[model samples]
Target chain A: MAVREGLLALLHEGPRHGYQLKTEFEAATGGVWPLNVGQVYTTLDRLERDGLVGVSDNEGQKVYSITVDGVSALGAWWEAAPVDEPPPRDELMLKVLMAIERSTERGDAHAMSVITHQRTVLHSMLQSKRRARSVATTSLAARLVTDALVVRAEADLRWLDLCEAQLNGTPTRKARS
Target chain B: MNDPVLELVDVVKTFGKGSTEVRALNGVDLAVSPAEFVAVMGPSGCGKSTLLHLAGGLEDVSSGRVRVAGRDIGDLDLASRAALRRTDVGYVFQRLNLLPSLTALENVALPLKLEGVGRREASARSLDALAAVGVTEQLSRYPDDFSGGQQQRIAIARAIVVERALILADEPSGALDTMTGDSVIELLSSLPGRFGTAIVLVTHEPRFASWADRVVFMRDGVVVDQTASTVPVSAAGAAT
Candidate 1:
């Protein structure tokens, strides 16, 4: 979520204090763009540093009003990039890989245990993803991200099954390593 | 009791072209009464979720009739069907899909507001829904702040808050620990009578499936068994 430019645009609506800005942003965007208090301050400081917003101190409280440049930046960001698509990183995969190392030193039992747990978790996740897909009433980018997650989760599950088979000393791939 | 809230007759869903195709659902038949709770169980790829989707109007069936509140879903135009879904169906998924930014109350209220209810009224009804699910204290908190059980409660609140006739939940309690899942199941099983909403839940856990007033088992896209047990069926009965 782009916080700075979006926050700046809200300031352009009127000169407002940080807390009020956060509250108004939440209400204005229908609770979609939630602003944490700390993040609101940090973004405001950066905006002032960049000369995109002018800060006025009144009664020991700082009020921020959007500068012309801030308005332009907000417009630019809105036009250029309304959504962010980050790459997928599987934290579970990392944990599973670590377990595989432990199993190599320990015993097949540990590896089998890991695989079993992952199977249960993946099955749950897949069902959840299917439900989410069914009721998705949101942006295209969000739906795409969900689709990617589901496919990746399913692939990890298939790979886990293969690992489980190998760990069990099944007669596949000629022989176990 | 005479007119079912939802009815699926010999539903079939297929994916891909002839030779390389897969039959996701095969000749499934089911019905849910007003305010009834039904759980669907099947192995992965057995079409339990497919049945839920057909009932919710998320996907169309290859063949068979899907009716919600006496209107055939297949007979409606795309826009009309979408409207029906927005107003008549509320869905809960295994993963809590609550928008992170929205407060619990707002997340619950989004559906009402989307359908053109005023903000104050939407918020008020959302608060009532949150209260019903026992999440009233967490009203202003975002989804990330709460535990999994609480989030699922909020999701449930969202599903039935609009007084939708049907709520389709796909593995609503699948993500949590056993204790939390049980709490969620209790919360879900209670809503039908409280809100007068029919529900179809897809789940793999027998304990979770047991929460339903009825259970329908599917295999290879067909409903193999259907039975109704009064509320609070024995654990052994659930396992079977």
Candidate 2:
């Protein structure tokens, strides 16, 4: 979340252009979080405006480097960074709830299709995460996030199971609704 | 030490009396070695579950001998049989029957906690067991949070964590998809050789049966066929 501080920490090592900073940030964070060119420029402008970084023309590009105050701010934030709490609602669950409602009116075919679509999406996401794991520098936070995603995928499969059983007219655990 | 993990000699389990009687197991004879992975496979109503229950000492034999872990279950009193189940055998049913409120880790730790292990120690052991089965990440999640394969693994983790001499599972992977079910079977089949815990699994699926180190097919309350896998038999006694 503190994109500026983390990028500033890297700049503290030496002056770096925006492109160089993006590459370093991707390396440090396991490449799971990709920084777009626009996002990087936006953050750079904010940092320069806040006096945490100073930019000067070097060669053909504007090279930005961290100020002394930026170094202390990055250190303090790193030491006391709070863990992100789990959000109260999940979008996938909302989708499933709507699918279940549609199943009653449109027949279980609708529900089965919805689940099949979700399964495909989740599987592709899982493959991407796995691929990232190999090329990316692994970090503790990245591992935890990947684990949470895996668990959510598993839960979706379980829901797919109940839906399949329902479509086949086989008995399953009663729906919550 | 050639003591069989389980042996049933001319065991007949009959329910009801006279003309209304039912013979669940009819003069059955079988032997299972220590730390072996054995699968009991048959069609519905073929007495597979009954055979497992009899072997694990959950039910009494009516006409002959039943021995488990070198102890004649026929000779053990009620109290001792209960103790044997508590300390020597772990049972998993098709339903899972995990407590709803307990997290996956807590569900796995119940048996150890019941055996007098302290809370922290039990949880530590449970976590290790979950990790062994590759379900450690879901340890804090409840059963409802898992896939069918994950839940089955957690059930298995609970069964083998306490180092039970024997583990009995009925349709452990029946609820999972083919790929996930196969993975679970691999996990169960590998567990015994790693921990020296003999396992007797019941399943109607032939694919599930093939994972066992040995297959003992039952029909009409008798062991109709038996075959060993790559591993050597335990060379244990079969006399009950």
Pairs in clash, predicted candidate 1: B26-B221
**Model 1, span B102-153: residue lDDT tens:** 9988899989988999989998898888888998695888899999899999
Model 2: CA > 4 A from native? A1-177, B236-240
Clashing residue pairs found in predicted model 2: none
Provide the global lDDT of candidate 2 against the true structure. Answer: 0.75
Expressed as tens digits, the lDDT of each residue in B25-67 for candidate 2 is: 8888877778887777655666889988998888888888988
Off by over 4 Å in 1: A1-177, B229-240
Whole-model Cα lDDT per candidate?
A: 0.77, 0.75
Model 2 chain B poorest 10 in a row by lDDT: B231-240
**Total clashes, candidate 2?**
0
Candidate 2 accuracy as TM-score: 0.56
Residue B44: error of model 1 in Å?
A: 0.5
